[model samples]
Target chain A: MDVGPERNSLLAYARNWLVGLRSGELGVLPIIGGLLLTAVVFQSLNDNYLTPGNLVNLVSQGAAISTIAMGLVLVLLIGEIDLSVGYVSGVAAVILAQMLLPDGSDLPTGFALLAAVAAGMSIGALHGLLITKLKMPSFVVTLAGLLAWNGVVLMIIGSQGSIIIQDRAVVSLSGSYLTPDVAWAFFGILMVAYSISLVLARRNRMSRNLAVEPAALLLLRIVGLALVAGTVVSVANLSRGIPFVVVLITVLYVVLNYVLTNTRFGVWVYSIGGSIEAARRAGINTDRVRIYVFMIASSMAAIGGIILASRLRSVDSNVGGGSLLLYSIAAAVIGGTSLFGGRGSARSAILGALVIASIDNGLGLLGLGSGQKFTITGLVLLAAVAVDSLSRYGRIQAGRS
Target chain B: MTDAPLLELRGVSKNFGAVQALKDVDMTINPGEIVALVGDNGSGKSTLVKSVAGIHQVSSGAILLNGEPFAIRSPRDSADLGIQVVYQDLALADNLDVVENMFLGREQTNKLGKLDHNGMECRALEVLDQLAVTTIRSVRQPVASLSGGQRQSVAVSKAVMWSAKIVLLDEPTAALGVEQTRHVLDLVLRLGQQGLGVVLISHNLHDVFEVADRIVALRLGQKVAELDRRTATQTEVVEAITFGRVSSVPGQSGATTS
Candidate 1:
């Protein structure tokens, strides 16, 4: 056809843009285009929507969900799902609140945190053992866990109405902020460390005769990261400084992403999801990794529960029973992570959570009812699934052709 | 040459429920040699190799490594003794790159105990170079992206990288094109010359004739004959494997192979 050349050029441009997307980095085109679209639409609709305070509130509110989504990403990576994480978090928060009851009860705050983490881990281990050892499907086991944990929460909080967190340190964890100068100092230090690691990793790949990313690409990454760090610091400076919750979420994001991408455990997760037999042949203790993954997911839930309760200053029996589960899974999927597993990143969950929060915030500002919000979320979920399936089909077709 | 055979299996018998997969099979592999294991389907080639690689325990037999009796309690134990097996399907994770597949369970780690990608990748490249497998340009590329022959090369390299005393390659060229088969046969010879005892298991006589230094024939779970490559013809080895005995062959020994 006479239009073949034009079509070819369009395809070439698309290919180049696709190639630039990697884990932990947003493609520039989509990000820029999205920002422009948001500004155009929201700035015209509501004057207060794009203000710095609301933006700060958005980040703070999204952090807890994002942190929990990070853990859910791990569960999904190995081709498994933990339907109980939401309720587990709720139960964890309930327990934490109960521990701070009026009388001389339970352990200190630090010990209680550790104990909560342990409880979550044990529950996760139980799930793993049931799945692998008993040959029960994870979906079934986790589904049962979802109901069981919810029931436990109800039983624990029975007739007590709800418990409130009064500890100053615990409350400050979600509500407090750093001084402006200290926030900048910390941001600078983190950027330096990240840049150094990136450079060293690139060099290591080169030394191994592995294909190294182009110098320009690597430089672009460093500059991009520095800019992001600077932007975050400035945003915090605009508000009441960086919320301690943001700092906590950022630390978990960096550390957890590092473990998932650079470590053997991360590789094992993908390998198991891709092919369990292959992982076993490679001498990885798949059972152990599964157990460990569940533990990590549960522990994160415990941390999430604490933060959520601190933000609310109270926990009820039904705190995590409802839409939290769907939202967490949605966060993971919206961030472009695959549900079928062997593909995805922890960072995507954070990004996805932000996307979810944006939609929620935008709709709320527009005074949309819960039904309309649900419809929008459902449509987004369907769109994500469609994109995932199309891309997967494309890959398979490419391979076959 | 080493006075002791690198690996020796005596009366290795394995049973699966009611089926006698390998009934009293015996084989020996010396250092710096390529031994072809030829047999028909259900001829117990897999059973013999599996026993040697510790994937299955022999019901009754003595497996010796370097003239010392070895106990293979598990696959890890066999790997520790430098006995490696590369199966036909090549149990490699496609999502993982060549270096990751090669080092795999034995990935190199630095003092921090993290995956030493540099060390593993460097060692993998070196092993590929030693195998003379030049088809692949990037070791960082996932094994999924590789051609059939290249994947085979990576699998063979994984077995040979740790200085395996005996490397068992099962049907390395069975699924390959003619050109890939040639490349793989060359790799087999290269591995042998590198002083590792290589056992090439295949049904293709042409491939055996091309690279194997010796031929061991098995029929119906029993080793019937063993022939030196220089002394026996292709027809002679086939007859021995198919009929359980050599009717006419000049220089080959007549003793029971197992």
Candidate 2:
């Protein structure tokens, strides 16, 4: 064996691994491995668990929670919390349902959706303004919003208990699916476009003499993405089709994910979340960004409400309350985002939501009670937080050296 | 010489409710000079600097900037007039990279209106290079990952890059080690050499002797001495500043240079 070069490379790799471990980047491996192992175990427990139909159902159900979780992720990164998302969503649903009541309604379907989104955004902006301009803590402002918005929801619902959305167009939004052929075609187009963009971006960085990954690393990332895309498409082809919810989730993920990751707005979001004083000194209009962040959170929640109403065909006073809020926060946190702030991604919300949904799906199939599921979810959340805290401490200690 | 100073303060005082932090202080920094301001704790050195930085409003003062009558009501107002203050705390975000921290509030945008990171990184690298700062590794590295001296370097570069005609540094080398202190002192001299007025607040006489062209001493919010480097020795400057006179007479410290 060639001892010199091989031993040197091994030492280098070891050093890299140690650095990664300290930085929390290596933390993802164990989580991914655990998820894969869990999936295999569940699939063996019941063959149906791995079937295409159930998987599609699993992903579809995660879309709404994932969207709201994305917003919560932004808020949390800024070292703040919004406790009113559930009620804000419920109020938005109630308002939308009222607008959708057929006879000579003052607003059309598209206009009604826009109005509902605006109203949700306005409520969020109001909270942000009260906190930033009036110098109130966001926690208190959002808590007050929690009670106030729920009251508005109850008033909107009246004594009717439930308001059914008979609008066919709205129902079709989250319930229908594209044909199998169309789904495959669309998936093909997406894969090609994604690959091209990745390649072009790498090339641009290389030409500019900016630091980028080596060619081998870039190839590995592209190949990995290809495999994931191919697997998803194959599984979708085996099922009936791509559900409308999946398409909706994809659209939201792509748009918001890009805005959060690759743009100035994304940088501002992280900066504000990291340190308000630092961000302000950097010349960011912190006040404006704060108002906009809250607005986005409430608006996305409104969209989540629309999806909920579309799927359930009704809106009620108790639509979004305790459990939904808990699930949304859990989804963002369990996806590996930091609760202490300045670290997280929009993609983590989807992952966390999937994890939550998977547990719910698995436990329900095993005939477990709601209490059992709740206990299990709580345990998972605790474990995730523990991992995060431990790794952060490790990073700090390493940094001190 | 023109009758106008680069920055002038008259009767600048600040009160925190019942506590009198600063009382009727007067000072001046001329163009193309290094002025070292020194005092003991609670001796109103910080209050005077804060007033100049616009972090605190003076209860009473007539301040002038570049011979213009100016009232700095906020940090933004001070920044607009090219007044950069580097506090001992450094005011840097640890999680952000060097370039990000340097251009935190004043980032360059591209035609697409995105943060033109390429240009900013290039500019940040150039600025550091011009200052002959070779201690830092990568400009992309977060400030948290840097050494104490490196962070101070970046903070100084930020103040310098902002075109600050008058840079006020508060205990810039207090938290620094020996090597780091030397590096900062060298940077201060370079700033003065570039014809930028510098107001350095320090307790270290060695550092003051190494960089400052003149020393202005404050004792309890009152100007006690102004010693040019060529005209006075360290002992004489210290005696004049500390006791507010050169000799201790029977009744009072005699007002004469020993």
For model 2, the stretches where C-alpha displacement exceeds 4 angstroms are A1-18, A103-107, A262-264, B1-5, B10-26, B30-32, B57-62, B230-241, B245-258
Clashing pairs in 2: A78-A273, A282-B104, A282-B105, A283-B105
TM-score of chain A of each: 0.90, 0.91
Candidate 2 Cα deviation (angstroms), residue A252: 2.4
Query: For model 2, how does the per-residue alpha-carbon lDDT over A58-175 read when each residue is reduced to its tens digit?
Result: 7777777887888888888777899999888888888889998876855778988888788889988998899789989999999998899999999988988998899888898878
lDDT of 1 by residue, B163-216 (tens): 787899999998999998888888888888888899999999999988888899
For model 2, how does the per-residue alpha-carbon lDDT over B89-144 read when each residue is reduced to its tens digit?
88787767898888876767867766677778878888898888889888987787
- Listed per candidate, the RMSD to the true structure in angstroms reads 5.8, 4.4
Query: So what's the TM-score on candidate 2?
Result: 0.89
Task: Give the interface RMSD of each candidate.
Answer: 2.8, 2.8
Error of 1 at A88 (Å): 0.6
Please provide, for model 1 over A330-349, each residue's C-alpha lDDT reduced to its tens digit, 9 standing for 90 to 100: 88876767788777788778
CA shift at B66, candidate 2, in angstroms? 4.1
Q: Kindly report which residue stretches of model 1 are placed more than 4 angstroms away from their true locations once superposed.
A: A1-45, A104-107, A202-211, A398-401, B230-238, B245-258
